[model samples]
Target: MPELPEVETVCNAIRKSIKTNKIKEFVIINPKLRWNIDANIKKLLSKVDIRKIYRRGKYIIFNFNHGSLIIHLGMTGIVKFLKNRHKVNKHDHYEIKFQDNTILRYNDVRKFGSIHWAENIEDNFLIKNLGVEPLSDNFNYEYIKKISKKRNVVIKNIIMDQRIVVGIGNIYASEALYMSKIKPNKNCKLLSTDNFKSLVKSIKKVLQKSIKAGGTSIKDFQSIDGSPGYFKQKLLIYGLEKCACGKNIKNIRISGRSSFYCSNCQK
Candidate 1:
């Protein structure tokens, strides 16, 4: 699945080329995605000028004259711009043709991505309950300590919760915990103030580095320009189960998700 950094990278690329353009036509090739892809999008979006494009967590928000378009790049989804001679491929589910003949194509092999039209996008249920962005001032160490005081769940799971903090996915969560030297299975309530501060810093550092590198491309992730991310090379111990650490870096299952951490360094 595309994480926050990957989604932000795509949003930035698309904003430059598609902003201020008018939507000439909109097409949905996959029916399963049509449910999330608003049926009245064509009617509401026709001729509406795209004013800006931004990202909130993992969703891309395209600001328009009367409304906004929210897009989620689920698993194996990529959005790319096609100039002339734009041809739709097998997984190209959604396309928005601009008056300038530029094409914004949304391709998702898993058919789990979404494109929705919202009159009041910020108030929409899809975005209303999201927690603070990891890079924002709202996610500081003091904020995390307050939230952690009442939670007894594992620190890894707490950070992974979208309600607690947005965009800390499994990979980044594991990476951040390892960097903070906190055991993934440690209870959130037991975390010291120092640990909380370090975790917050690690989350921001790791996410900032990943965004700069255009996100980590573990499986099927690409920027809006169809470029693969380069951050995977900097991973410390997310997938290296056999790395020779003084203590084992065991792979454990937490909340039905795979977690990787060095037993010696973390805890």
Candidate 2:
């Protein structure tokens, strides 16, 4: 699945290239995605000007005069811009054609990706209860420390919770915990203020680094340009057997997601 960084990359790319551009065509080759797309979406978006494009969590929102178009790139989904002459791939399920013939196409091996039209994004159920963005002012160490007292779950689970903080996917969560020298399985009650401070900084650092590298391309993730992200080469603990501290890494599942840490390095 595309995480925060990947989604942000797509938003930035789309915003830069297509903002204020006029859409001449909107096609849904597969309305049977994660949810059925509105039958009138094509008519609603045709000839509409894209006011802006942005990301909220993993969903991409395209702002227009009438409303917003929300998109989610579920597991194995990718969106790319293609020329009119390029043959549409077998997985291309949705597309938008600009007046200039530029195509913004969505492809997914699994039909789990979705596109929804909404008058306002806040009313969208998918993002209604989402937590603060880790890079935003609301996700400071003080906020985390306060929340920590009320939650008894594993520290990793708290950080990864979409209700507590949005966009801290498993890969970045593990990397941030490892960077903060906190074991993934540590209880929230066991964390100190200093630990929370380190966590906030590490989370921002890792996420920013990943976005700068265009996001980690573990499986199907790729930039809007179809370029693979370079951050995976810099992964420290996730999916690794050895740590930089010359210690064997430990693997455990937290909330059914793999959590990697070096017992000798993380405390």
Candidate 3:
């Protein structure tokens, strides 16, 4: 699934290509998504001007004058901008034809993605309850300490919880824990203030680096231009079985998600 960095990359890519453009037409190749495409989505979005594009958590928001369009690239989804007419594939489920002949196409092999219409983005059900953005000032050492103190689950699971912190998916959770030298399965409550500080810093550092690298392309993820992310080449522990510290990297299941860390390095 595309996480925060992937979603952010999509938003930036699409914004640069389609900002200030008018939507001449909206086409839905199929309405069957994770949630059925809203019936009024076409009526609300077609012929409107795309004012801006932004991201919240893993969802992309396309802002217009009167309303907004929200899209989630659930699992095997990619959004691409085309300059000319091309062969449409079976998975190309949604599209927006711009006035300048540029096309924005949404293709998902699994059909797990969704497109929603919202009059006000903040009040939408999907955007309202999401926790603080990991890269924002709102997420800091003190906040992580307070949230982790109340959870008995492993630190990995605690950070991965969307309500406590948004956008730390499986890949990032493992990478952050490795960077912090904290065992993924260690109880959150057992972590000291210093440990929480290190964890918070690691989370931010890992996220920022991945975003700069255009996110990790383990599988199926690609930039809007159909290029694979280069961050995977810089991974320290996510898919490796050994560590630079002369220790084997352990792989375990925390809340049913794979976690990687070095036993000798992490406490």
Off by over 4 Å in 1: 242-246
Q: Report, for every candidate in turn, its global Cα lDDT versus the true structure.
A: 0.84, 0.88, 0.87
lDDT digits (tens) for residues 69-179 of candidate 1: 898887778888888696668888878888888888888888788888888987888888999999998998888889889878899988988887888888899899999
Pairs of residues at least 3 apart in sequence or in different chains that clash in candidate 3: none
Ranked by TM-score, the better of candidates 2 and 3 is: 3
Ranking of models by lDDT: 2, 3, 1
Ranked by TM-score from best down, the candidates are 3, 2, 1
Query: Which residue pairs in model 1 clash with each other?
Result: none
Better model by TM-score: candidate 1 vs candidate 3 = 3
Can you give the TM-score per candidate against the true fold? 0.94, 0.95, 0.96
Please name the candidate that would achieve the greatest lDDT relative to the true structure.
Answer: 2
TM-score of model 1 (CA atoms) = 0.94
After aligning candidate 3 to the native by TM-score, how far in Å is the CA of 173 from where it should be? 0.6
In model 2, which runs have C-alpha deviations exceeding 4 angstroms? none
Query: Which of the two candidates, 1 or 2, achieves a greater lDDT against the reference?
Result: 2
**Would you give me the overall lDDT of model 2?**
0.88
